[model samples]
Target: MTSGSEFPFSPDPVLSGTSDDRQHALQLNPQQLLDRIPVTIWQANDQGQIISLSARWQLITGRAPVDSLGEEFWNSVLLEDRDLSLQQWINACQQQRPFVLHLHLCSIRGNSCPFLIQSEPLLNDTDQLIGWVGTLQSTDVVIPLQSKWDYTQKFLQALLDNLSNGIVACDTQGVLTLFNSSAKKLHGLPLCPIPADEWASYYHLYQADGTTPLPQAEIPLYRALQGESVHNAEIVVKPSQGKPRTILASGDPIIAQDGQKLGAVVAIQDITLRKQAELELRKSEERWQLALQGTGDGLFDWNIVTNEVFMSPQLKQTLGYADHEVDNNFEGWRQLVHPDDLGEVAAAIEAHLRQSMPLYVAEYRMRCKDGSYKWNLARGQTKWDDNGQPIRMIGSHQDITRRKQAEMELARLNRDLEARVTSRTTQLEVAKNQKEALVVKEQEARRQSEVDRAGIKLYESIISNIQLGILVWHSQNLESVDHLELVSTNPAAESILKMNLHVEIGRQMSDIFPSFVGKHPDILLSLVEIIRTQQPRSIENVPYTFPEGDENLFSLRAFPLPEDCVGVAFENVTCKETNEPAFS
Candidate 1:
């Protein structure tokens, strides 16, 4: 009957509310809670219009809420798979059930970021299907083609498409064929059938250094046509349409059973991030060399083939050794390191030599001349010969003892704060249990005791379990309190005054907490004013005086409780405290 009627669950919600539906309008403050959720949430109406979406969608996708609406949001899905994805959504809508699928969402950089979408239909009070809500989570799972035309082709294409590396094959004449999705993405070519050599100019193929333009014959595809098996041929593929990507390519000829020429195939692995890191290290080394006249860093170079090492004067100075005192070689540096860290440092260098890692980096304790250990960070870069053999290595060392000590200090402080929070959490739990117990005890006490006794018992129950110094104040007919009497006080509140709750209660606010009186004192009046405004207010790190003449720091908050009563919570804080407590 309608566009999405084929699926009863995917309903276009008619945005209308009844006069009798006032409860739905005031149901909850959804945004205050929803924004805190980790997942990317979205809501779409039955008519396929986006009603609402989470702020995180903009943060992750870089697409503003106003710009990404309805089908436009899904339009970024790979064109070949969009129709199938649409049908899947329709099925989920018809069933009115949750749907989960692995798909790619286009990012701001115009690259596909694979993610998992889990969505469910949203309904109203009368079981009316209104819309849908869903979350997007980044997933590593590759969404394979669901509809394979034939068993063999479907299986073959799905296998190729899901691979992390690009795969491309060509006929002996170099006619392009067997180009998988990864290959297409890496090359940034159109989906239309075409030959790589013909499109090579348009793709802007570059040499490994990312500056020299590669000739058509020198490109990986053409080199493969020459029957050459290339390995680790670093080619920077700078597509005119997409971001530049550096790929390590390997290709071998496809030989027939009869040894006849049968085109070739190449596997391309994107190593852009790795290449960028290496480039950065090289640049940093140059900067370090130029600044050697000013910085405190030490420099060293090692010729791997000759086993010869050269150290700068600063290098020896760093270890408190006179220049030229320490000999060159592994032994020169090894003896200066902590015995336990020496083995790991040697292993790190050896691993780098094996090409198991891009660079050698380690932080370890080195023995200073004073016999104390100091933390030092070392980073090494290797130079490889044309034949792929390591020829030389050079790097730098920097003293990082202060940084290490600060890290340990921060960790200790975090542990202390966590312990304090844990203690406060236990107190809150006890208070909650006391409230539940009092509700039951008060019901039974109502029969035996007077109303005043029942009320006092309830007030005392709250005061006993609370960790914060809490002061309860009564309101007068002025919509404010002319009576400055302290109606109730927790043990904590009374302790702040160097007295007991029985002594503090029924006394004037000025007589109990000195900070609430005198010339600048609206601290109590502010609390009363905040209650009148129906809003909570807090002031931090203010001075409070006790009856014992002790001045301490306290952060205070006042909020309206049930009835016309206002409750003020006093949080004792130290000058060293940094975080401000939230008021609700």
Candidate 2:
């Protein structure tokens, strides 16, 4: 019509714009418009294949537009949400409405990039769906940053809650930022927020010497804030209700990315048991050294695995070796032992090892460098590992040569003395037996003599009652008349005897009977002859007269006694004036 300049509907009708203007107002170049938008925009067909994408979509995916325009573009969605994003886009196109989905999208580098996608249907003038258009914006950092921060905070709190050792952190302004359960207990305070000014009242740190508060430079946590790590620093914390307690503290600094100091983390441990053990060990070593010195004994430690021996200085001196001269090995020790004692020494050691008992003790000779052997008394004990296997041995050695020599000499002297005593005792016993035998013989002889004397007295008494004069004389010496006395006489002889017969014990017969000595010399001779012959003799019908009486007839009888003695008896006969011999 414009070309023809002819139109039935003309400007007279309510027409203000031309048809070209109307067509221009209703048309848009989707690609060019999408490229101008800030959000990522895309169009997909009913089959969910990408038809077009904005320049921003290519920039975020780092892909060319041609490579990204396909159903495969949905592969860029995270595997966990790909199907859901596709289904949502399809439903929105069918329903002819806008739909929103939150999905993780992957780029060309396979990194997850979160996005919020809002999709709406594109329709034709007949209201039939053509495709879907969508816009995507990255919400990776914004959507979950707060939740992540909250989770991190809770995890840190749990860690602090479960810690056993005290933990504390402070800011550069000396403000308490974090305190753990253990820290509250250590400081003897409730788990309430502490003002900065009151921090010193709850937690007081002291130097190891305990004489004064720790200088700021030496405090572990303070040092840590200055970018230093402290380990095993002693500290003392004064509690509100109790005395101060000792602790070992360690700390390190927490730094930010810009190397700025954030705060410090500190840990404390109680070391009272360790300190007491150290003190006790020192005392034990001192006592051991003193005891070894006092006893003049040397200590030795031996390691079985290494075959090495450690000897005290006293041992070197005792062995007559310089302090460093003696070797510390089994062979070295064996070489120093005397040849004669080596067997016994080795046996003792073998027995100890085999038995796994407490100790082994023995005395043996050890060769000195000067070619002399000295006796040594050694005692050793085996030490075992936890599994009951021997690992080491410790022992003592002492010089006993002088003592041993003295003991040997004393033993020899004792043996000699004992032998001498035994010999003397035997000799004395023999002499005693001989003396006793002699005494017994003497007693027997005395007993026999007593019996003979008793018999002689009885015989003399019997002969004297025979009314005769009796005499006894020694056989070997008849004249000596060892025992002769008047026994009895008739009334005539009692008057003629002229001597007191009762009192004449050792008197000779001649002295007591002197009248017979002259007139009866023959009778005395006969008595002597009978004693010498050990025979009986008699004289009968012999005439005799007394000096003061009438004439009388006398008869004599004599007999030899046993063991050289003689007995004699005499009888007197007189008539009564008629021719009758007197028989009285």
Candidate 1: residue pairs that collide? 11-46, 12-46, 12-47
Please give the lDDT score for candidate 2: 0.65
**Worst 10 contiguous positions by lDDT, candidate 1:** 1-10
Q: What TM-score do all the candidates reach, one by one?
A: 0.32, 0.35
Global CA lDDT of candidate 1, please?
0.69
Q: How many clashing pairs per prediction, in order?
A: 3, 4
Candidate 1, residue 485: CA error in Å? 81
RMSD of each: 34.6, 50.2
Note the Cα lDDT for every prediction shown: 0.69, 0.65
Name the best candidate (by TM-score). Answer: 2
